[model samples]
Target: MKPILYVGNINYSSWSLRPYIALRWAGIDFDMVEVNLDQPGYGDYAIAEILAFNPAGKVPALRVGAAVIADSLAISEWASETGSSLYPQDPLARALVRSAVAEMHSGFAAVRRDLSMNIRRRCKAFGLPADTVRDIARLDALFAGHRKHAAEGPFLFGQRTVADAFFTPVATRFRTYGIELSADAQAYCDTLLADAAFLAWEQMVLAQPATGFSRANIDRLYT
Candidate 1:
């Protein structure tokens, strides 16, 4: 089966990265189609074509044969079901992983807004809003709980899962924005940055033709 994923710029498109990482991590083969998000025709031209597969007219839509899947959660679920090891075989473990991935999909709105995902652009170090800070603290608590109860290897679940892929872009946002993270979270971020799949993705991102916006600071992320 041929799978095509419509995505945006790698340096900034967190949603695109979610399914991309999930597929790559799970060894699912797919083609990528990039859309110029900064252009004026994004909504009418780029998004309209995307809407043929995804009603939301958004990037990161997954096209599998005649079926179309929109939204990262849906796409990732499809990846898991098809050929990816996005979740665990164990029922309880799979449930735990799904819960974590769902929280990442729906929660952390403040962190997302305050610190946009810019893989290539390092921004001025800024503090988070009160609620976002609270959210980060909550994340730290969650990680700690995982470490205490469910931890096994470098990742939250000892093996890479959809949960890690979901948060991978958030880790990039924290790195780009220079958020002050706790030791556990920082360690987690380091593990993600060092992943071979993520490194390969970063190299592909660097190889893309330069877009004028943020061209000045794009190379810093790879080095």
Candidate 2:
């Protein structure tokens, strides 16, 4: 049987997008199960549904037969095992990619809290908190540094990799929040935003039921 990817609100769940993009980039076929997290009884009903498969009650859990992978980063790692495209083939390059992916998987608290991942809405933000500003600077530096070494392609490591998958949502956040990036970083952001798999996810958001949280609030969540 094909694996099933359990996800939450696609527009807001950066975690869900990571593995979804990675698998699609790797050309691995899998079915998706979207758990409703915006409706009433979210604590009782939605949480229960997620807990059916993931004790953490988080979205983007993967089910492959009897085994369940319960984290987006872990699921992306699974997709990378399929071929050399999801990660670089060279040892040093692969390690660098892993470090990039890991940073996205675990860090960037300010961006997550302030910007959120509201793909359906476009809004401008100004005079952001200090932490959020710092995060954006870090993003610019990271993207610029990666693009300099990206001799093979537009993607960070020259070709599509899990690092790109992990950063795609952040790219969207930058666009949605109107955060400016350096010329090099902005070029990389353009490449990520225009990716086919990323576009497919956006289309999916467009097609969700009216009740779905595919439509997000335009307002930023931070002070």
- Tens-place lDDT per residue, model 1, 1-223, is 6799888777778888988888888788899887766654464544555656677778888888897887787888788778756776799988998888888888988777666777766765544469878877877766656664335688877788888888888888778877777787788888888888788778887887655444333334333
Where does candidate 2 stray beyond 4 Å?
39-46, 209-223
What are the C-alpha RMSDs, in order, of all predicted structures? 4.0, 2.7
- Cα lDDT of all candidates, in order? 0.76, 0.84
On the 0 to 100 scale, the lDDT of residue 111 in model 1 is 73
Clashing pairs in 2: 153-158
Stretches of candidate 1 exceeding 4 Å from the true structure: 41-46, 149-151, 209-223
- Per-candidate TM vs. native? 0.86, 0.91
TM-score, cand. 1: 0.86
